[model samples]
Target: MKAIIVDDERLARKELASLLASHPEIEIVDEAANPDEAVEKIEKHDPDVVFLDIQMPGKTGFEMLEEMERVPQVIFTTAYDEFALKAFDYNALDYLLKPIQPERLTESLNKVTIKSAKSEGKDQKLSSKDQVFVKDGDKCWFVKLEEVRLFESDGNYIKVYFDKFKPMIHKSLNALDERLDDRHFFRASRKHIINLGWVESIDTWFNGGLLVQLKGGEKIEVSRRQSARFREMMSL
Candidate 1:
């Protein structure tokens, strides 16, 4: 797997790079001294995983992740053990303390290998040209992804909206979101994922949020937290 190491200390970066050299599966793609440099390298390289330093000169590791368009697997390397709990909140691959032991590094590499294998076994994200098999009761249809306008969460099932056919699929909205291409399908809120191509109009909503009107006359409220990201994605 391709990886990048980010740390302010030159010696620390060298030490980690030397240790990682022993592992054949990991290729050190690049290194950065601070979060700004890290972000630039990460965007350019698009590495599979990043060995990140939580405490940086400018932005914290978490803050940098928030600004990223696509986030790769993160393995935080830090001197402080106090940030351990918070590190797991980002679903990091592993948290390695400073002066990283060879054994600990091996364990983290193993986790990354397993995770990569699992991802490879799964199908790719649903694209605009792809067709999905949907069934409700005794009726079923092979629906194209572009034709689907919305996916609404209804308990454990997702209500798929198409041309006059609303079928319920036994899948969570979160699961569907992971499988759909972000360029087309957008998660506007907790309960809804709307097709950007189907959006007809947009207006300012309450609480600094925005209201999206779809082609089928459905209005969905984009949450305040996701509004900025949505605006960036849609270039609004």
Candidate 2:
């Protein structure tokens, strides 16, 4: 894939570029120091993917996205673990922490190049569907977008409820809502977000909210504040 390195530090950029050089599938088209330069180079190069640094001088990586009409697949490179969590909330293609490991980088590349292709053929889309990488202790799963029934707030982390598993990921529900496509996932209450596609039944509940049951038998309560929109979205 055509790619570019965007980092404020020259040494950091060089290090990632050098490692990327070993992969024949990845071709570095250009490099940029800050968001502005990155934007310019991106428009000029039109690379297939970007290795973006979250913390830059003027604008962070997210701020750079507003300048583009269409964003390419992004693999964020950052030192802060907090920012990496936020990056995942944005549904970024992948995240590589600083002192990037070769195995991790290879795995991320495989996801972007091979898994993404399979996802496209399998009908996963940015607006209507998505896949989330969930790692719980020693277990890992590449969860399909449709299978996600609900997302619950768990202190500083969000607990993803799907199938028979409930995995706690280091992200807030608000952040996850912002990343999720509105057409598929909606904030049903202060602490819960539900996937519309997974709702098997809906009924009016106390305080003007609605009760939703998923195919997997999980019952989620949609709060009164969002009930009106929920009804409209469900055409009721």
Question: Model 1, residue 86: what's the lDDT?
Answer: 48
Q: Write the per-residue lDDT of candidate 2 for residues 1-236, one digit (tens) a residue.
A: 88889999999999998899789999898999999998888767767778989889878776676444335667889999975774465345788999999888898888664323322322233444344456555344446667788889989988888778897877778866776778998898889888898889999999998999988788988889899999999999
Summed backbone clashes in each candidate are: 0, 0
1-236, model 1: which lDDT tens digit per residue?
89999998999999999999999889999999988999889767767678988888778776676554345677789998866654453224578998899999999988764223222323556677654556465453445679999999999999999888787977788978998889998999999999999999999899999999999999999999999998988889
Residue pairs with colliding backbones in model 2 are none
Model 1 pairs in collision: none
* Whole-model lDDT per candidate: 0.80, 0.77
